[model samples]
Target: MKRIQIEKIFHHNAYRIGVFFDKDFEVIAILKRIGATYSGSRRCWYLDYSKASYHKLRFHFPDLVVVTESSNTTLVTGINNRDLSPIASSSVLQLDSTLSNPEHKQTQITSEKLKLQLLPSIGKYWVFKMHFHHEISKQLLKIKGVYWNGNYKSYMVFRNETVKQHVEAVLGVGSFFGSDYFTKDLLPVKGKIKILPHTEATSWMEVYVPKLVAVHEKLKRFSLARFSKSKNCYLLPAAPIVMDSLHLQFESTGIDIENLLPKNYLDKRNLPNKKQLDLSKTKKSLLDMVPVQAQTYLSSMIDTLLALNYSSSTLRTYCGAFIQFLRYFEFRNPESINREEIIRFLGSLMERGLSATSGHSMVNGVQFYYQQVLGKVDYSFVLPRPKKEKKLPVVLTMEECLQIFKVVDNPKHKLLLLIGYGAGLRVSEIVSLKWSDILFEEQKIHIKNAKGKKDRMVMLPYSIVTSLQLYRELYKGKHYVFEGQFAGEPYSTGSVQQVMRNALKLTGLEKKATVHTLRHSFATHLLENGTDIRYIQQFLGHSSIKTTTIYTHLTKTAVDKIQSPLDRMVDLKSKKKLEE
Candidate 1:
């Protein structure tokens, strides 16, 4: 290589040009002379191929005169004649070199190839257009030459040779995506592929994010690619295999690419998968899975479940459980929940001196937290409820039942109590019973949307039917058999129980009998009449036969006492003492 002296440097059309020793720069080639601008800010020179290079050089290097211009025969005479020896050798060498070379070398850079792969795949293709600059990021399809036409809307690539050569020099490659040779359509013409870009640093790490993720996924197979502060914005090296697998999907499904990519610049390798989270939902402090507005009315969640035709008893159990749960949790939002937190909460319920029934409510509430609230229905850990005391239900005899009915003055209240005990109905089952639920013609009462939201039929008593007919004649309404004072609301279960107590007081029935005792009486009476235990189980809607079996112990045979074996033995010694 020969050194050329920089006599002068000047700018033309925002490009700097340099005039070296003996004006040998002009002897380079025909393409070099036609059009080019130079920038000489840092002593490093570059050319802008769209502008005239020589014209600008003439103004700065005025002291030198050009004598000839015949391809490689350009001659220049300068006033500085002291260094003719160095000038002669350098000038001759430069001329000989350019004249000897008819072709220029071209090498493709990996980054440019990557950019070509990324551009078409990006969903937000408009973002690139938003940052359009004439000379900075001009599209390859726009403009006649490599130079930008200052028109942002242009979409043509550089078609001129000199302009292409200029870009090749600056970018270290020429016509990457611009050429049809790399396209899928032109692979036949281009022959073998050159190279693919891969770096320890990910796309996000680079100052300019070259490839869109949609395209990157096609090029790479990655499942989880995360950005780390240690590696700046680039994807971390851990779990390369997983990320590769995910990338495959991204390539196939261009949709949801942005969702696959993480936003924060931190290692998220420990984070769970979409299906692997501990709780179906997170607590308010951790992550907001259920909307806050929805959680505010936690009771309404249960109500909605009911409205959607879930069992009324399930609604009662779930809502009651949730209410107790909120009290235990001090009415906090049900977010940021973890498995351990729930376990502790369940443990606390037993620790707090709550009954077995209360414990059941808690289990149901927490179960709902996982199922309905978090949308995670797969609960492996089960919270066992405390064992309820096996107490015999208080069932009044037929005479006692009649006594209470006689004392009850209110026709609706009396009918409600009579149906509860006489037909074996729960308070809720009784209140919710519509006129249509009563099948007097068939001597059956249909309970729809009962305990487990199940529908069942119960035998209607002849005596209660006659009383009901009399009551119906006296009272008329739209909905429930016993409607509330308000038009739509049904009579509350508690109100029915209170009315039962009042009727018992008036009738002078001394035995302790609740509205539920009426149901107990129905069950006990069935057993007393020798009805099969399994049949009774089905009638009462008990989940277990053991529940129905409890009524058998209340029967006269089960309740009757047997003489002790010790007492049955003869007392001969005591008899002899008495004879003496």
Candidate 2:
């Protein structure tokens, strides 16, 4: 290896990188390229004290050692004839050999594979286009204003220095950052996919996501996908796998991808809403449902619910249920409306075939206002409610559960279903899961801040742990175990439910199973296998054993063993007939 003398010294009353090396013709040419100039008096080459020259020297001669003396007070002796040797006092700076190492070069090549582009502004948002990397995506998701721009196949963030810094830090150095080509490129007008109604599953599916480049790019993955400008839609050939994948891919992007799925494919059911039912942001406000005369009652009910620190879910439910009462008694004040009127309003809801759960919520909401808000004493007459149906939860048998698992093609979706049945997690709890919750040593998954704001530990099957280990290595999710298209938010329960619905279609199961049905199956199966209900209760994070014991009613393991007296009587009759 060769040596280059690099020293910071006063050159014309300013610091410069003084170079001292032998008069090799090739070395001189390289020094000249680094902006080095020869001083006739000192008889050595010199350049400005900057990093550019230092890097250039390394790039040109990766095998050479650089001895740097940056005391800033080091001065050269005038008219030195011979080459200056290394001074004992000056510190020796070794050359960077990593630049010449093949392993290091491979690392650079791997990192360089990830490229990014700055897309045109999407309304107020600045867009960044790149291939998704979990770690890089996680950092971007940390910014509060970042959005997954599905239309652009990019991330949209609010224009700010914090976002800019985060982007620069997360994405390593690249020339793409300084490029201007993307700015001039015309972008398509963004929109969402609209599925056209079709009768047959085998027929071509028509999608209307106008100029949505992301959708266009995705369509290119399948064969014979065409854009029909005449009909203002895109027509694509149908495949069940593609349909299921399409829903799973974009559903997490905050789009209602369920609507894009064909009805015949999913076998649609009147499944209870997976969303929180918060109507606060909807266009039709609860106040709008009531007459102008009765707006105050509705407003008061909401304000009261909020003041009481009721959960947002409860607040929405009460507001929704109470609004019906307000609209019915529009002419009269809430105080004037008695038990009979309240009963009549509920009766009407029952006539409309509202579910028992909804009916109960409506009753509880009205009761809160009358008893707490109005401070009313209980009258002799009871305020009536819809009869509470003792309906059994739908449970999938062990073999049936395997069938559903077999049909699930996506690994993440499969793991999601596995966790649901294997761990017995609720739809809400499953979505809110974070990577930090998984405990390998304890063999448990921590369910924190769950229903009733309580934390509990649930068993993590060895099978799930193995899958999770492989998945974590691949995805490396920082926040949630399963993230949505956007970074920080948990996977939407609705999306998981859609995945469940899609999987059931592939299997010929007639049961109207939901994501919750997996939880029910988990509990019932565990009970059948003789897992104590008390432990099951704890594992399920149930507040009461009664809630857990419901599985007992569904598990026919014990009941199947009991022989009927009629069977015994039939055997006796058969014996008598044979004897006769």
Candidate 3:
């Protein structure tokens, strides 16, 4: 006869009856189907404790030998084939006497009446449903890895040679019918949860497909999910509720949900299983990357930037530039490298022929380190900065922009370029966008916490709205408007630049342009169309009208209208030559 042990245990913030077994698949499956949840820590399946929960166990498996236990010893048959001790002997437990005693002699339900129902395994378990007396139920419960499905009123049991052998050895083959369903994966699995490296100490489930889009639309609907391109998965907030939600959303898609049990723990380490973050994506600290002598200064600088609530991009740029300065004074004291030495360092950087922009960034990075981080060090000496280059912003003609878009075949890539040229967004602003920022009803994108810690609204052209909706449906990007390879993270700034480069190459445009060129083109094209400079300033998120007016120099239509002196005086020489 099949044997199981039951005892009251507090779990899941409730009193539950812990169902113990000898790893019997059938008994486990029955318990699971009837709403029992498994606890790996307890190494048993559990059901909510109640009168119904207790009697329900016997309702299914009548012949099960239930041994109840106390806080003390739960000894069964000893080596001597007799009770070794009076105080720690095995106990045959009886339920509420009003219930356990049938009150009348019961007719035995025999195995001949139990017709085994079988089908191919849907996933790890064979799915089957049956209606039978408790005696017949005991026969099925003898099989290993069995679980009851309360929803379908079925017992989906494991089918394997190991389980079959266990049954034949424990109970004769004649005791229970062999109803086997081949174990195999059935559903089309489009994704699986992976953990990102950033969350190793406190684990998280990062669900990802092999490629661009996630398998289902609902995965993107998770409010707490964030996309990590470095890990190429949607990083989920570590919570049991999130795991439960994932199971509900992906159970039908079939990607080894049962195997992920270890990841769903409530501990800081969480997921479907306690999957740690990917090792490859773990970033080295700037402090670690710098010379050992300079690490102290770099650590202080990073802490100050974080306390100020600076954007991650700003923190990275400023810290990186400051690290270069620190490296120069690796042997010198950090406090001593402030005034005259800083200017000399700037001169050395200029002498290397770096860009005017790099010079400006380096100045700011160094200034922040001294003023904000060091607190009392007012290094106000005149710094030798590189002369600002006066080159105008590169602007693509409307025809050129259109030609590039036409040559690009990927819908995702095409939409990316169109947003760049049409929306007048900086490359940084574009990549930080989330789908929640889209205001389709207003036909504007709510640019949240943009550069300089300001919010602004930018137009969403009606022409690209359809494309945006279609892209959302096809990609089902969670959170971000232009999600990277997977949902959650905005498309990478590097990927956006690469898309621009690919388009320019395909269109054979030799013009030197970066992703920001699209923004310049957007502003210049608007100016050419006679949009007021103030409105253009708002569209470009420029704090000053002077910044917007730079587009005036780039507008071809305005420049074309003003006839040049050379063009006006051109006809006289040509006319004389024609007459001669």
Candidate 4:
């Protein structure tokens, strides 16, 4: 077995130690037995300054070398101190050459220049005066029992030998000064500010400050820091300028700023808050807002969806739609809400310029909530949904598809685009693929738990087999074929869409096409090549034949083979002229 190398150094008045060894689990067990705990922040194991602990560590590892303030000396038992050169007085400790050295490791102690003055401030506590830099400031803040004194503008901690040793180990030994020795204040007061949504109006914001400080004074000039007696928080008008100023001020003072506004408040402007408004008086103007009582009902609806094993996207859509419906009733009891109210609520949505597709979603979501969760079936007939608009899928030609593939240079992105088009797979299906899903011998790609929670198999394009093999080798140890930055998770849908957008820009194609368009083009091309409609239907995973028939209109196979009657009539007239 290879020898284990351990480097021991005194840092921040504590004995900081690190152990490097081959894949030997025994050494780890030994370190754990010694009560050495790992520090993620320091990236090492440390012990409190104790001479007895140092002697015990040397006993365990007979060949250990301890670097001390004296020189580059070996602490091993029975080793002679002859022929050792005394290092510079500024140097701390130096380990053997075989040990791995960190690039930013400090070789000399510069704490003498670090101006640290400890003095008695109040009963049982001592105040410290020191110039703050990045490294020293972080170390001082990390010391146990140390806290910032806001009034004195300095740091204070309990007086103890352990604490003094830790501070001296980091900032070096300092002299105790008289109470009035230092007068300048270097520390600044810090506080936390929380901004939440106001219940009174949409344009109003609630600011919660634990204590009135300089931040509160700065906020008063903008007429945004009025104290609310009822809420016991500061109330301000929600505006871009107000938010921007608060963000800048809190960030500058090193204060923790927490903004807890609702998604609607952050996304939209000029929205009227319905809390103070008498929304019950106006039935037609009832918008789809979340009601207070709707939370319990929405939770039950979500539980039902999860129990039924619905997809995450479907659950989010259903919950959002139901929340809107419940908000219209102002969170009234769901059992008391009749079908007439549901109809009125959906009508209000349409009047507010909701599309037919959105109207369908609202109708389905409400129906599922009432029928599935509440066990009501009679109200289904009363909630009539609008007809879905008939629209054709955008299909790119073979030449255009080739142009897209040519423009994408990234191997992973190119493979994603190819699989989308080559196998007629949806954007969601392509990203969720794993290494186990690809079957090279069978020439099939298994799609499990796809849309509608169904499973299907698509043919693997022979042309992309080599590229897939190369990609698998490049991105090893991935559960998903196209893994994200985090292991085991599928590639993000937005990233794939961005790749398509870039490719489209390079092709200079005027047609508005997305990643799904590649799948559409694949189906169209297969149909144009005389592939059976039944086969195309299975390939595209369409549940109904009617859904598959839409591609017939996009194909030119039938139209191109037929000759028009007007052209035949013109041919007869030309023949008669030639005979004359």
Backbone clash pairs for candidate 4 read: none
For each candidate, what is the lDDT? 0.51, 0.66, 0.64, 0.66
Ranking by TM-score: 3, 2, 4, 1
- Top candidate on lDDT is 4
Error of 4 at 146 (Å): 30
Clashes of 4: 0
lDDT of candidate 3 over 172-235, digit per residue (tens) = 2342435543434544655554433334535565565544244434556565567777866667
How many residue pairs of model 2 clash at the backbone?
A: 0
lDDT of 1 by residue, 1-580 (tens): 1133332211322322233432222122212333432322222233432224443444444444331211211213222121111112212212212423323232222332222221332111111111222233434434234332221222233233554455445434555334322122322211111111224533322211224553344333222344345533334232333343334333323223232334443233333432223122222211121234445646445545644655444554565556545544556666655567777876764554455665676687667766775666675656666787677767788788888888877788878887888678888899898888899899999988777667888888898778788777777766678987544447877688879878877877778778989899888888888788887887888888977887877887545566556655556656777899
**Overall local distance difference test of candidate 1:** 0.51
**Which pairs in model 2 have colliding backbones?**
none
Query: For model 4, what is the alpha-carbon lDDT of residue 50?
Result: 47
In the range 340-407, model 4's lDDT, one tens digit per residue, is 77788777666545667777878888889878898776654557778777899889999999999999
Name the regions of candidate 2 deviating beyond 4 angstroms: 1-284, 347-355, 375-382, 576-580
Instruction: Report how far residue 89 has shifted in candidate 3, in Å.
Output: 77
User: Relative to the unseen true structure, what is the C-alpha lDDT of residue 167 in candidate 3, on a scale of 0 to 100?
Assistant: 42
Error of 3 at 116 (Å): 53
**In terms of TM-score, which candidate is strongest?**
3
Which tens-of-lDDT digit does each residue in 155-229 have in candidate 2? Answer: 876655555555666676434233222222345343566776444433566666645566666555444456777
Each candidate's root-mean-square deviation in Å?
A: 38.8, 34.1, 28.3, 28.9
Residue 371 C-alpha lDDT in model 1: 72
